[model samples]
Target chain A: MFKRKLFHNAYGKTLPYLLLIPTFAVIILFIYWPAVSSFRMSLYKVSPFGNKTIYTGLSNFENLFKNPDYEKSAWFTLFYVSFTVIATIFLSFILALLLNQKVPGSRFYRTLIFSPYAVSPAISGTLWSFLLNPVVGHVNYFFMKAFNVQVLWLTTKPYALYALLFSSIWKALPFSIIFYIAALQNVSDELLESATIEGAGTLRKIWKIQFPLVSPITFYLVIMNIISSMFQSFAIIDVMTKGGPGGYTTTMMYRLFLDAFAYQKTGPASAQSVVMFLLMAGVTIVYFLFGERKVHYA
Target chain B: MMRRYKKPLVLAAEFVLLTAISLFFILPILWIVASALRPSGPLYTYANPLTLQTFFPTTVTFDNFVHIFKNLHFGRALLNSLLVAVATIAISVLICSMAGFGLAKFAFRGKNLFFFIVLITFMVPFESIVIPLFVLVKRLNIDNTYFALILPAAGNGLAIFLFRQFFSEVPTEILEAARIDGASWIRIFRKIILPLSIPAIVTVIVMVFMFQWNSLFWPLIATHSSRFEVVQVAITAHRSTEDTSWANLFSSAIAGSLPPVILFFFLQKYFVRGISGTGLKG
Candidate 1:
C-alpha cells in the first residue's frame, strides 16, 4: 500500500510536465530554434546549397540599408501599415457601433460584415486584382465611363500601393469589427443608460462613454493590424502586384521573401527577418506601455 | 417638440448611412461571386461595368470552375489543402488540449514559468522565423511534404493559451469528485473533461482549421510540386498561367475562397465565440 501511495504521488508530480512535453517540444524545435537560427544566419553569408557560410557580421544589414529599393520598400511598408490600420479600425469601429445599436437586420449586417474574415489573403488579392486589372477591371471600366480617366491602378506607383492598402483593409476590417462588437457587448449598459438619461446625444454617448470603455479592444486591434499588415499580407502583395509594377508595393516582409527565394540570398533575408522581428517587438512594447497608462486612466 | 422631431430624423439618417456603408462592404464581394459565374467573354461584351450585370450576371456558367478543376489540377490542390488542415487541426487540438489540462488542473513546479513561456511564444509572430523554418524543414527532409505544412503550425501557443483559459474555468469540484471515486487522471479527463469541453474543442478546431486552410506563404515555398500544392498557392500558379482570362482567375479565386467561407456559414457561431474568447479583455 505504501509503495502504491508513493507511485501515485510520483505520477501526480510528473503528469503535468509529461503533458507539457509535446507542446514545448514543438514550440522549442520549430519556433524558438528557428528564431535563434535566423538571428545566427543573419551574421553570416550562407550559400544557397548550405555547404558554404561566410561569417560577415553586419555587412548584410549594411547592404540592406544601402540598397535604394530597400529604402522605398521600408517606407512603403510603414505607409501601408498606417493607412490600413487606421482605416480598418475607424471603419470597423463605426460598423461595430451600428451593430451594437441592434439596428434592423443586425444579424444580416453581422453575417455580411464578418464574411471577409474567412477570405484567404491570397484569394482577397486575387479578387481585388480581378476587380482592378487595368484592361478588364470593372472599376477601371467605371472610371473610364464616368470620368474619362484611364488610371493604371495596379501598374503605377502609389496606385498599386493604394490598391494593396484597400484590399488589406477590406480583409482586416471584419476581424476588427467582430472584435469591437464583442468588446462593446461587455461594456456595462447602465453607464450608457445614465448617459442617455443625462441627455448625451448619440455621438457624445459613443465618443465619450463607449469609446473609452472599448479602448482595450482598440489597442489590441492596433497591435494586430500592424503585425498583420506588416507580415501576413505577403500573399496579397505576391498575388496582386508580385511586389509591383516597379517595386512600389514591396513591403519589408515581401522584400524578405524575394531576397530569400527569388534572389536566393538566405543570409540577407535572415538579416531582414531580424530587423522586422525587432521592429514588430518594439512597436508592440511601445503600444503596451501606452495602453497600460491609458487603461489606468480609464 | 423640436427634440422629438429631431430624434426620428437623426435615426433615419443613421439608418440610411449604415445601409449605404454595409452596401459598400457587401457589393465588392458580391461582384467577385457574380464575375466568377460570368461567361468566358470580354467585360465589354457584357453590359456596362456600372450596371447590375457587374454584380449580377445576366448569363452565367460554371465553365471557369470546370476548366480549373479539370485542367489545372485544382481538385488535387483542394484535396491537399483539406488533408493539411484536417491533420493540423487534429494534431494541434490534441497537443494543446493536453497541455491546457495540465496547466489548468495540475499544480507543479515550474507551472507558472511554463505558462509564461507559452505567453511569450504567443507574441513571437510566425513571420520572423519563417525563413529559417524553411531551412529547418529542408534539414529534416520534410520539405514539400504535408509534414512540412503540418508540423510547424501544429503546436500553436495561442491555441494552447486559449484551451488553458477554457480548462481553468471547468469546476475543480468535478475533478475532485472523480478523484474520490478512484478514477485515474487520464480516465477522468477522457470521461468527464473531454465531454464537457466540447465548446473549447470546437473553438480550437475552427481556429486551427481556418488558419491552415487560409495559410499561403509557407505553403507557396514549401511545396514546389503541384502534387503537394494547396489551394491558395495553386490559385496563384493557375493565375500566372491563365493570366489573360479574368473569368478563370475569378473562378479559381472563388474556388479557393469558397471552402472557408462555407465553413464560416455553418460554424459562424463558434467562430464568433472563439474569436471573442481570444480577443483582448479589459
Candidate 2:
C-alpha cells in the first residue's frame, strides 16, 4: 500500500515537468543556445566566402569603437530612441486625457484613434513612402502649395532622418494611445470629481491627479519605446530609405546588417549586437530599479 | 443649464479634434486605395496631383491586383505566410498552454526558476540573438525552411506568461472535483480546463497570428528565394531596379494588410479585453 502511494505521488510530481518539455526544448534550442553562440562568435573573425574563421580576442570590440561609421550609427540610434520615447509618451498622455472626457461620441473617437494599431508596419511604411515621395507625393505637393517650401523628403541627407522619425511616430502613436486609454480608464472617477469640487481647474487636475495615477503606464511606455525604437525601427529604415541616399540614415542594426550580410564581417557585427543588447538591457534594468517603486497598481 | 452648455461645447471640440486625427491616420490608406485604382498613365503626373481628378479612379480596374498575383507570385506568398502563421500559432499555443497549466496548477520544485526564465527571455530583444540564431539555423540545415520561422516564434514568452496569468485565476475547486471523479490529468485538462480557457486561447491565437504574419526581419534573413517569400517580402520584391510600380505595390500591400484588419473587426471585443486584462495584471 505504501509503495503504491509513493508511486502515485512521484507520478503526480513528474506530470508538470513532462508538460514543460516542449517549451524548454524550444527555448534551449533557439533562445539560450543562440545567445551563447552569439557571444562565442564575437570572439572570431569571419571571411567573405564563409570559409575563414580566425580567433580574435577583444579585437572586434576595439575595432567597433575605432570605426567612424559605428560612431555615427550609435549617435543616430540614441537620438532616435530619445525623440520617439518623449514624443510618444507626451502625445499619448494628451490623447488619453481627451478620450477620457465625458463627451458625446467619445467612443467613436477612441476607436478611431486606436485603429492605426491594426495596420502592419509594412503597409504603414509603403503608404508613408508613397505619401512622402519627393516627385509625386501629396505631401510634397501640399508643402509646395501651402508653405511654398519643397523639401526633398527621402533623397536629401539632412531631411531623411526626420522623414524616418515622422513615419515611425505615425505608426507607433496608436499603440501608445491604446496603452494610455487602458491606464486612464483605471483612474478613480471619485478623485477627479473631488478635485473639481475643490475648485481645481483642468490643467491643475491633470497635473495633480491624472498624471500621478498614470505614471506607471508612462514608465512602461518609455521602456517599450526604447526597446522598439532600437530593434523594430529597422523595418521602416529598410523599406523607406534602405539606410539612405548614402548611408546617412544607417542605424546600428542597419549597419549590423551591412556588416554581417553585405560586408561579411560577422565578428564585428556580433560585437555590435552584443553592445546593443547590453545597452538596452542596462536601460531596462535601471528602469525597473527606479521605476518599479513608483508604479501603483490601483 | 450652464453646465449643460459647457458639455456641448466640450463635445463639439472633441468631435473636431477626433475628426482631424482620424483623417491624418486614414489619409495615407485612402491614397493607397486611390493610387491603386488610378490609370497607369496618370500615376506619374508631378503637379497639381491632389485634385479630385486624381482622387477617384477614372475607370475602376483590378489590373494592379491581377498583376501582383501574376508577376510577383502573390498567391504563393500568401500561402507561405498563412502556413507559417498557422503553424506558429498551433505550436506556440499548444506548448505555452501546457506549460502555463503546469505552472499555474502544480506546486513543483523550482517553479520559480522556470518562471524567471520566461521573464528574462521576455526582456531580451530578438536583435541581440539574431546573429547567433542565423548561425544556428544555417548549421542545422533549416535556414530556408518554414521551420526556421515557425519554431523560434512558437516559443514566445509573452504567450506563456499571459496564459499562466489567466489560468491561475481559474477556480481550483473545479479541478479538484474532476480529480475526485477519477479523471486523468490529461483528461481533466482536455475536458475541464481547456473548455473553460477558450477566451484566453482565442486571445493567444489572435495575438500570435498577427505577430507571425507581420514578422519581417527573421523571414528576410532565413528565407532566400521567392518560393518561400511571405506577403511582406513579395510586396518589397515588387519594387524593381529601374522603376517601381507604386500602384501595384501599394495594392498588394493593401491586400496583404486585409486579413489582420478583417480579423480585428471581428474579434475586437475579445482583443481589447485580452489586452487590457493581461496588461493590468502585468
Docking class of 2: acceptable
Chain B TM-score of candidate number 1? 0.88
TM-score of each model, paired residue for residue: 0.87, 0.88
Model 2 chain B, poorest ten-residue lDDT window? B273-282
Candidate 2, residues A1-298, lDDT tens digits: the string is 0111111234477898898989989988899888778777898987767478899999999999999888988898888889988998898889778877777787777776766666677667766777787877888999988999988898787889889998898888877787677667777778777778778998998888888877766876787687777877877887788888788888887888777767767788789877877786678778877775666342
| Best prediction by TM-score | 2
So what's the TM-score on candidate 2? Answer: 0.88
Q: Across residues B1-282, which tens digit of lDDT does each residue of candidate 2 receive?
A: 113245676678777887888777776766677777665554667225587655566677788888878876788988999999999989998999999888777777888899867766755557668877888889999999989889888887778877886777677777777788988988988998787777677778887888888888789999997778998778776667687777777788778877877776677666555544543332
- In the range B97-170, model 1's lDDT, one tens digit per residue, is 99988877776788788986776565565766877788899999999899999999999877887788667666
Interface root-mean-square deviation, each candidate: 5.3, 5.2
- In CAPRI terms, where does candidate 1 land? acceptable
Off by over 4 Å in 1: A1-11, A47-50, A66-71, A145-147, A288-298, B1-11, B70-73, B101-113, B119-128, B168-183, B187-200
